[model samples]
Target: MSSCAKADASSSPALEKAALLGREFSLAWLRAAGVSDPEVAVLFDQVILIPAAQHASARFADPSLPRKIVRTIPWSRARDHHLVLAEAAKQQRLAAEVVAEHFEAAHRFDLARAQWMKAGETSCHAGDYKKALRLISRALAIWPWDEAADDRARVLREMARCATNARLTDEARKAWEELADHARDTGKHDLRADALHQLAILSADPVRAGELLAEASKLATRELGPEEAFRHGLAHVDLLVNRVRVAAAKLAFVAVEEAALKSKNPALQSEMLGWKALIAAMAGEAGDATRFVEEGMQIAITHQLPEQVAFAYKRRANIADYAGQYSLEKHSHNVAIRYCRESQTGEEIVCMGCLSYACFRTGDWKEALDTAREVLGQPDLHPGLRAIAGGVRGMIAAFRGEKASAFRHLDEAIRLQRAEGMVGMEFLTLWALAYWHDCQGEGAKACAIYDEIRTLWRESDDLHDSIPGLLFAGAHYADHGRAVQLADCIDIIGEILRKNDLPEARATLLALGAEQARLEGDHEACDKALREAAALQIKAGLPLEQLWIESRHPRAEDHKGVIALATKLGTKPLLARLKGEDCGDSASGLTPRQCEVLSFLATGLTSKEIGDRMGLSTRTVEMHVSRIFERLNCRTRPEAVALAQARGWIKLP
Candidate 1:
């Protein structure tokens, strides 16, 4: 200002006049330097016009000088000065306004970025990817060129992966597209590779997905260093592993097995090995399944991957349960649960399901009930697990004699199975419902459900192949006097037994044969059958079955044999029943009508002859014999006669 003042003073009058009127020059200069309109207006009022007017007033000693100068200047020049001052004010305002405006814009940008970051984190945490993707889009719009945008883009790509993990295929596709666009725009090679990787996952066309992942792997290998690129290679292997597993689940086992053998990633190789084990188990290759699971276990143990260890355990449990090794099944389930808990994984539901079945098979109903309760509480359980839990509960209720409650649970299980399209499990639920009906003595209803199950089993080709639902159906029919059906079921059971060399099947067949012989009234055949059945029962260590068989044959000759066998078997209850010594209450001393039926049976009279002699329907006579058998702890007329003679209720001549 000192030099400028001296210059103004020493300048020619014409130049000084020009300087005094230099408002246009100042305005143009300030405008060019980015001053805003409002700032220019303020400068006009406080600096330019006011200072000039005050200087003119003080120097001329005339208040009129200000007015004279204002008026004497050409109208065009005056207008130009006013316009220039207004423009300078505008430029000043624009420059100052832009600071806060840009700051607010930047703040909005930061907020959007933070929102996207939170969404991405939440998506990764909760596996809800659609919301994360939408939030990221909003962020990109707000701050497309932000410094942290690349990091956020990377997160968006990861969110896409989460979408694929959650099975949100469509949402994953959208996220992949966005990531691809970002990669293309920003020239981030790693981002490009990641986007392509996700695109591989999102692509419904498996061929296209494979191609994309292959390209991505090659690109990553070329661009990224070894440490950074290893993850991409692993991801590519994981995709192929998942694809193969999906195909295997759809029953393309051979192809999937071949693909799994070709996998390179250690974790994926272990997982595919487990899948191969499951397929082998299903295909009835127990030895192969065991070998595959062992290999997978070794790999998982070496890696210290608890989740993989849990998976291996589960596969082994399934194989054991399928082979009816209840103890081994229980051990495997325990290992699975331990590993799942250690890894903080949610596979406890599967382990609990296995434990429930194993406990049920081993006759530990209380343990089964407790494990089923725990399975029901897990929120992350699959629908199939819900159905299985309900079925286990129904089994517990049935065991406790709560028929109504059991039926309710069975119905709920059926409903869930149908809703989930779990056809295999639906058959199991139906079987339970039929068994419940059989327990309630609703034989007709049970028969109808059993027929449906038989049809389903045959259609699914699952009978005696893997699951044995049909075998139970056969047993149910055999117990209820469907002999022809029982014989057919016997053949099926025999084939399965012969093929598998199962001792349990031999016992079931012997029991069924004994029941058939008893129904035909061939005492010799019945005696032989009962002796053989009891021997097999004893060999199997089935004290209960031995008791049941001994109770079935109670004629004087048969009774002697039964009591001898029961004594040998240490079955006191069966021994008491065979001796006919007032076992428990004795049905309040059989009614007079029962005595009349017993008299005819003692005389070798048929129910028709008894009906003719007593002037009653044959059905009525048969009913009397049934009641007499129930009252006398006997299963046949001869047994009833023997018991009556021992009780002095009838003279057997």
Candidate 2:
């Protein structure tokens, strides 16, 4: 109906038949469709065909001409041509997807289904998951499930796999659930266990996910070999570890380690050792963590297993982080990222996310921001890693005064991390958001967030989470004069520090103690506590935390080093807060009274009115105004007010 001038009524009948083959059809296909050699030669002479870019012999010169010509023919005639083309394609061994299309056009769906399944499987192997999903869905559409149970089961498995790879979580879950039911009915325990394992991976509800994993592990142990069962056991342990159930993770790891040893797979043993190291590190078992790391590193290096090697290094970094050895943490994470890169296991982004946090802790804000951005830029990054990168980006943005970007990233990080069961990352992001609010003087909002964190900590009763939680929340409460709330957090922190004995934890407790002293107006106690906290923070190598403790010193001149370091780190938020503390000596050289007058000038108040408010004579107010303008090198009151505000010398409100 739609005309390409090249395809008119006068076109050869053989060409019209060839058009049923597709836009592109071979000379041999035309002959096999019963077109004579001379007819093909005549069609070529008429310039109705052209050389195809594909290996096919020849194609219609105007591709649309084929569809037009085919439309002109009756369905019966087209069906015959399609059947012939399908046969020719089968003999020529064309792509299964291509052959399936011809067979479907010929209404031979039984034949089409097999080719479609094959095509889908091929696409899946090629990592074209969306295409594979489409093709498998097509195969399922035409074939009745009970008619061919084996084919149906295979199609469902591939459907779930492709859907998972495409990140269609709901669809993948449904398919896996269906497959699990089918496997159970068929008494295929191994298949059922594998389906359950996949379901656990997609489930967002931690309790339901853990249940599924536990069942999967039992089934794998009962029906599969030791190695397969160990794999499932390790997955369960990993879920527990990620959820901050450290004691439960440790208990689960005992069986997993036994299974790994029974399997006698060196790589699995090494991987198990790595998880042991991480769990031990988190549980404050430093000696056990060190022993596991040594054994894991030796086995991984001996086997030249890059992924296992990376796993060992990442656990070592975890140990360093727990001990407050930030420089070693950064170096170990770098090595882990390097090994991840070499292994090509798609875990480099996750390691980079860890590096970003380490860099942030060490006051390398620029590198942290860059690494976070790079990790976030990956389109297919795992949800947990995405949460990590997003948190880092949000925290850095909050520090640099990008309020909107900070809120957006931080909110998404919390949502995704919680959904992915990354409790540790979720807590960190919440703390960052609360810290951002604190820096903005939104004390109520900051405390509200901290309250939510405390509620979660109470519900989980996870010491691994509580140490950082209580410490950070206490810092916020202290800053905002929430003395009762600060006392509560301090008590919990003191209890945790007694057992953990981590230097960073001790420093945070000391800092909170200083704040408590300041609130009570005990200047000597505050100064002494601050000095101890600052020294501990320095030994722990946490410059940012150390800067905060130093900046809290009542004598601003004594803590000039804090301002200098904050400036060098380009931590704009800290610099802003520190400058506010030392506002008496502004860069503009305006005296405290003169700075006060500059704020009043910005409000368009006359000298007499400002004098009335300050209990000074109009002449004295004018003199302060003149001094402000002279020091600011401004000729007009408006100019002086604007410049002073720009330099953060005063806030009008």
lDDT of 1 by residue, 477-548 (tens): 544446687676566666656544444456556656655664565657756766776676566444434555
Screening candidate 2 with a backbone cut-off below 3 angstroms (N, C-alpha, C), the clashing residue pairs are none
State residue 558's C-alpha deviation in candidate 1, in Å. 12
TM-score of 2: 0.75
lDDT of 2 by residue, 253-328 (tens): 7778888898888898998888888888877778888999989999999988889999999989988887667899
Clashes of each: 17, 0
Error of 1 at 336 (Å): 1.4
Give the runs in model 2 whose Cα sits over 4 Å from its true position: 1-108, 118-128, 301-307, 337-349, 377-379, 461-469, 479-481, 581-653
* lDDT (Cα, 0-100) at 73 in candidate 2: 84
Query: What's the lDDT for all of these models?
Result: 0.60, 0.78
* TM-scores of all predicted structures: 0.51, 0.75
User: What is the alpha-carbon lDDT for the whole of candidate 1?
Assistant: 0.60
With candidate 2 superimposed using the best TM-score fit, by how many Å does residue 278's alpha carbon deviate from the native? Answer: 1.5
Lowest-scoring 10 consecutive residues by lDDT in candidate 1? 54-63
